[model samples]
Target: MPTSDVVVVMVPFVAQGHLNQLLHLSRLISTYNIPIHFISTTTHCRQARDRLHGWHAHDNFIKFHPLHDPDFTSPNPEPNTTTQFPTHLQPSFNSSLHLRHPVADIIRSLAKTSRRVVVVHDSIMSYVVQDVKFIQNAETYIFRALSVFYILCFNLIRLGKELPFTLEMKLRLPDATATVSQEFTEFLKLQYSHQTFHVGNIYDSSRVIEGKFLEYVEKDEIMGKRHWAVGPFNPVEISPDVSSSAQQDRHACLKWLDKQPEKSVIYVSFGTTTTFLECQIRELALGLEKSEQRFLWVLRDADKGDVFKKDTVRRLELPEGFECRIEGRGLVVREWAPQPEILGHFSVGGFMSHCGWNSCMEAMTGGVAIIAWPGHSDQPHNACLLVDVLGVGLLMREWACRDELVTSVMVETMVRKLMGAGEGVEIRKRATELGGELRRSLGEGGGGRKELDSLISYITR
Candidate 1:
């Protein structure tokens, strides 16, 4: 196995967070002169190709292997764009999950070439890896883009380490708030079913699983296989080189930040997968509006209501004219926000985040205080680590569980406390220290660097 020419094929879950992390990992590996081919369905492939258009790699060095499931017809297809999260509720999104044969065909073609074919997939898509291996001489690996705690806790349950606690009881953790319902559902789903994406659990473990724990599984083959914890992939490193659309958005955001006081603004955003019921959104909207603090809110579905209308994909109705109401004090980012850039800014004092591991890495690395609002899945646990274990930030309880409804008053109080001086000083300081530590870990001779090197070595071994 030679390092120079071996072809590593990376496939990601349909969601952009997973797709973006694997893409960044490919960029890191592109320097080895390895031909990296990314595979996904048509929509995901298009976005991947677009992002790599001006990539630093050599010409023809990187490519995409996109497949269409011939048997699965998309129902709400063309109207839904890549920017929005595709809920399985949409009849059009069925193709996102049914990729076994389409991806298998990609491996078959790559296997014909003299170079070895290794398929690295997101855990949500791990089911397809088995099918890829059945193709001639192909290999399979798993790359998880989730936080280590999320991985460790979930797997400990599967391994029965949390025995006798009973599934109904909260899975006790070193972090203060032990995960109960959300985590249990994750263990049950991943242990039993592969289709983790569910409408009710919106952003639940059903959509993603803890692949990091797979390394600990007692299988000889799994032990021998290549696995990498190659993430909280830094967006700051990749922000300087962004797609044209991304650059435009980045420019607008940075320009706004330039005028603000240092560390005075709290940046708010939920990753693509978290969808809010109207009441929840109203609470968040009013909360931010009434908080009377300088902020930026990237609302994924600002204009949405109880129904999905074909015409409303681009325009969402917030607490009508909410942007105007907050005018100078806040900015509501409706389109895709450049999160890494915002977090890395000096003026960004705090982050009101979804507690997605990726956002945690960015905010912590930037040394920004957190207003942890974990709506679903591992977020509540991620929030616990930030607030209780790490002592980095405070939790926004209004939006904790998926069904939890936060009020404007609650949101306002958190905003003032997080953005104002005094008690928040210690939390901010802790977040800064943690951010520095994480950045160092990903930097020269850092743990992330060593793991990445080992991954490269495994592929070329």
Candidate 2:
């Protein structure tokens, strides 16, 4: 067992992807018997706990410290906006800054009892832990909740390093025009500046897929801060009881998957933050109907300004009779669905996704082939990795075409190409092979395991 004298504190950004990554990492660290205090807003802490699985038995080792931000406002959805990014989330992002003082206080209190207080904060959440440097026994590490490929490319571009890759293919750095608000832009700048204080970096990536990119991160003078690639932070195996009774009851889609043929269903989801216009939703529905493939689709509105607010009776609607037309062949879930469980299902062969990093890691680790429909931010880079570098996915549409309404015919063609037997057969084979490698990396002798062990030793020693 690792030393109990060392306590780790986790601070994550409020986004679902960022929170989930840190929560999983906390679970992994708890296995070493290191106490972890996870700091977040009360709502976000609830969000993490609700979604947490595979580590229920280790709950004692992890303590959730919910900070109340009285001034924070919930996001109100703007239905007519053409922006592909989740600009509605700006309020929540801004509210997260209010956590700085309370988070610092928690760190100071933990530092009093522990010989070492190692803080693992999200890359975007550096402001919350900036005061840790003054706490003599405390040190911070920036935990990148993104692919190494995206991080290294973003860092290289920031340093004006000429690369073989084009700007469109890389993860773009935040700029004044890039964000919806000036406050958000300044918050992003603060996040970038605080990185210099971190003692090291930790990435939710694996050497199996990003070996070369990991090397690039290590050699970069500005970013080479003793990093560790201990990821696919999510569990490798799907737990039978991943969700609570209520969630399982809501997820009838899983029960539906069990009845399908092996490698036949195409799991379709755009993640929590993506919201589509009625026209786009209609086009997507038409394409799925025309493709004549078995599919499970998670349909939900883009997050509201306030995530915890009661759902409005107004919900995004599909074309009339769309569900009836594809009755047995398609399942459209309006509530939250267990993505990792669905992707890990034997019946799920391909994923039609928005190519979020968390979704990419889940799909890659599950060995499910991807139909990439990238939206904005790091998604385009993640799509590039999945479709170009990994050769385990096919691109449906690019971010450049996001404003243009993708016709039903175009969607039908991409769906057919990914689910059909021609090129998809090769893609599936590669995905399966890659999934095996990723899962192995989480096992005894794998690179992820080695790096995780190294991280524990580095902190506990």
Candidate 3:
């Protein structure tokens, strides 16, 4: 089949982290002139297109297909990237359970064109897509947006292999309490609760990234399935002109960064999906206030939408007198701040992050040290790799496995250790060096590009 006739259909979870990684993967694959059909919720499709600055020119080579919610009959049917999306209606968009039919239709249509179609969907969709073996000239691949470390651990859990219980011990078992949500609880349970590999079912293949730039662990002998390491799919450079409704926050963040000393500020965020209890939120606020370091904090309110209208933002309350205490040294923004844009800033020295794989990859690309504060999912494992294996991150000690309400003192100590002069110096140096290595490994003849090319060849051959 001709390269032009080879189409890759990519489906990402509705959340930002999954969508961002898969969107970049779409970019990498489309560079070879092969067409891509990226499936996402209508709101998320517009979100992707808006953030994807250069791809406006790739109209013919790429397409963003929207997945609709048939049950949304209350009259507000527009797309939403942030809190504009009603809380009750969000599950319909986030899960593959609802997307199964639409995705199947996409596969069937592509098969009819006689084009070689490869369906690359988020790992959560495994059970639903596993049975989609009837399409002609179509292959399904599971795109694990997490790291090899996380994937290996998950596979072990599924096989009931004994695992060392360390940090994130809550997720070590199925019945452990969750800080995330009921929806995430289901996603967390799906992998271990079922036997994932079924002959002629499940997936034809799975893909992962080289975590902390380490060697890939051989898994075929254990799982009886092939896994491809094709990433560090995080883009080396992010365009600053990407459009978003939160333009004011972006401008304020950049303008504020301009006034700070180089490498003197830490960027703190827990991502869009990670849930935080009221006390955890209070502890973080008090900790940053006590750290005495210049910082930018992304704080979102748990009870309401991110925005009330234009010019107003909603977020949980901070410690009383919090702003005045850190007057010259802190700036807080509600809702999603432009993470890539912030991380790329030279004045930004380190990140206090949830250690989500996408956030890890982005921080590495920008060459910043991380203070791994994992909250949920495979994040704790990713944090383990960052701090223990890669030597680029420091653990908060208090944020390990559960909703442990870390006190202000604990938060202050970790923040100070991360940003102040001392052991963090070596970690910062290593992080910078590793960042360079990751960037080089994805450039022109880099391993990631080569692996992607090989994947395309295999699917079409």
RMSD of each: 7.2, 3.0, 6.0
Off by over 4 Å in 2: 1-4, 53-58, 164-183, 241-250, 311-313
Candidate 3 C-alpha lDDT tens digits along 234-335: 557766554565455456778888799999999998775555656777888888888888999988632211112233323477778888888779999874
Stronger candidate by lDDT (1 vs 2): 2
Root-mean-square deviation of Cα positions for candidate 1 versus the true structure, in angstroms: 7.2
Model 3 residue pairs with clashes: 301-315, 301-316
TM-score of model number 3: 0.80
Put down candidate 2 lDDT per residue, 88-117, tens digits, no spaces: 788788777788899999998888888899
TM-score of 1: 0.77
Per-model TM-score, in order, reads 0.77, 0.93, 0.80
- Candidate 1 lDDT over 1-461, as tens digits, reads 32334788887866566667677667767766778888887666665544332234344667877677334333222223321233332332233457777777777777787367767677666665556645655676656556645655666655456522334324433222233344334433542353232101001111112233334432322223334555445543433545777657555777798789998898988776566666667888888877778898887642121112446364445888887788877887776666777888878999988787777876776789898877555677677667766788898873323344577887889988888888788889887776766656567787666766666777776
Over 4 Å off in model 3, which ranges?
1-4, 50-59, 72-90, 93-95, 127-131, 163-219, 222-225, 239-250, 302-314, 398-401
- Which regions of candidate 1 fall more than 4 Å away from where they truly are? 1-4, 48-59, 69-94, 163-227, 238-250, 302-310, 398-402
**Would you list the C-alpha lDDT of every candidate in the order shown?**
0.62, 0.83, 0.66
